[model samples]
Target: MKNFLSALAVSAVLVSCSKKEATPVPEKADTAKIVDSINAARTKINDSIRSKNHFKDFSGPHTFTHNSIKNPGSVHFEKIKGEADHYNIKGDIKSGKSYVHIDGFMAVVSDKHMNFTGNISESVAGSENGKLYVRRGTKTFMSKDGGKTYRLQDMVNGSGFVEYIDIHF
Candidate 1:
């Protein structure tokens, strides 16, 4: 009888030891689904705007003339040190003695729109540093020696223009 009891105890211990433990499964996050939903909503808004032809009035054909600043060798805007909204615009005109260097601030109108407006804070041409306004998708104008002089670098065929920059934010 004692032997029978000891055998039963050993069998119970072995069975308990041989059993496998179950591991818990982790749940997946829904971040990807949320991002996809936001992207779909933005696309729907853009499609609605396009269907209404909201941007049709701002479209025009570009004509390059001799007066235009032709063939800019290289143009680049670098952020100014210690200034978040300020930038240094530097560029060279091909085959021309003129050089352009200006300080400006870029303002974003929307997630897809932006513009630059500032003074020709400095220039090599002369003391003609004046207000420089470059409206994206519209026109670019520079005033030299203050507002006393104005030069149209680029413009559409209309008197008034709406400017916007194409960008995805």
Candidate 2:
């Protein structure tokens, strides 16, 4: 009986020793999913910031109305160092297969007024097809409704015509 009990104990020990615990397998990283989540988070943060500071963040796409014709355009506004409510502006407008580019500075004089001084560069259709004429001039714009709308008193290439180019924000 003692021999039988000792053999049984030995068999139990051997079986226990042969059994192994399974190790967990690591998962492969999904790089595309990670990147998409990161981009979504960044966009959310940017939208929050834009909502809080819409006036300062008006540096994106805008309507560039010139000669009663509205054009699609984009503007970049950078805050000037050491200046209050001043910005350096640069933008381009797509006008009927031609592009009009402007580089300028803007000053927020008051809550209801703003001023802009810039140089305009535009390509005009010449007398013949495929011929382009470049027009360069200075422009001064004023906004009385807190940048909601701007009136261009000075135009590109000429003045006595009193051309009004509205820049709608």
Candidate 3:
């Protein structure tokens, strides 16, 4: 009888384990909140007015890659010494205003990769010295190496135009 009881208990356990969980179905009306949430989401970053302070100011060297466009490239900018407090990211818009922070449903559709150069100097890692760009708003990008000493825009080439480092095949 004990053996039979143990087998029954094992069978019950297996049966219970085989049961599947139901996925919760959200109410249809709840999805209506999408439009309302979008309207209310206009508080900061993507929705706010852009300025020089919208993006980050750095005190070291860093690598930034622009991977959102059909084609992509990179930039290596080094932070000038004694220029942190006065640091500014200078930028202008091509179609609309720029952002200083991350915001909204704005998919930063472009992929980006950055490596911060912690307290880097001209002595080592040899930085590119005078490259500048505008991301959005008034925030501008700056580099110090003919825009090539550090950042590798191999996919594109620099131009007199400030935005969109034009790359031609």
The Cα error of candidate 1 at residue 136, in Å, is 15
lDDT of 2 by residue, 130-154 (tens): 2333334444566777668776665
Could you tell me how far off, in angstroms, the CA of residue 46 lies in candidate 3 after the best superposition?
36
lDDT of 1 by residue, 7-105 (tens): 999999999899688888888789999999999999988766544422112222222111233333333455544333333443333234333333345
lDDT of 3 by residue, 49-148 (tens): 4323223443332323322222233222333333222322221112112111111111111122122222211111111222332232221223343333
> Model 1: runs farther than 4 Å from truth?
1-69, 80-86, 97-103, 119-169
* Highest lDDT scorer: 2
The TM-score of predicted model 2 comes to 0.48
Which stretches in model 2 have alpha-carbon errors above 4 Å? 1-61, 68-70, 126-139, 144-146, 155-162
TM-score of each: 0.25, 0.48, 0.17
Ranking by lDDT: 2, 1, 3
**Comparing 1 and 2 by TM-score, which wins?**
2
Q: Rank the candidates by TM-score, best first.
A: 2, 1, 3
For model 2, the run of ten residues with the poorest summed lDDT: 124-133
Note each model's CA RMSD in angstroms.
14.8, 13.5, 20.3
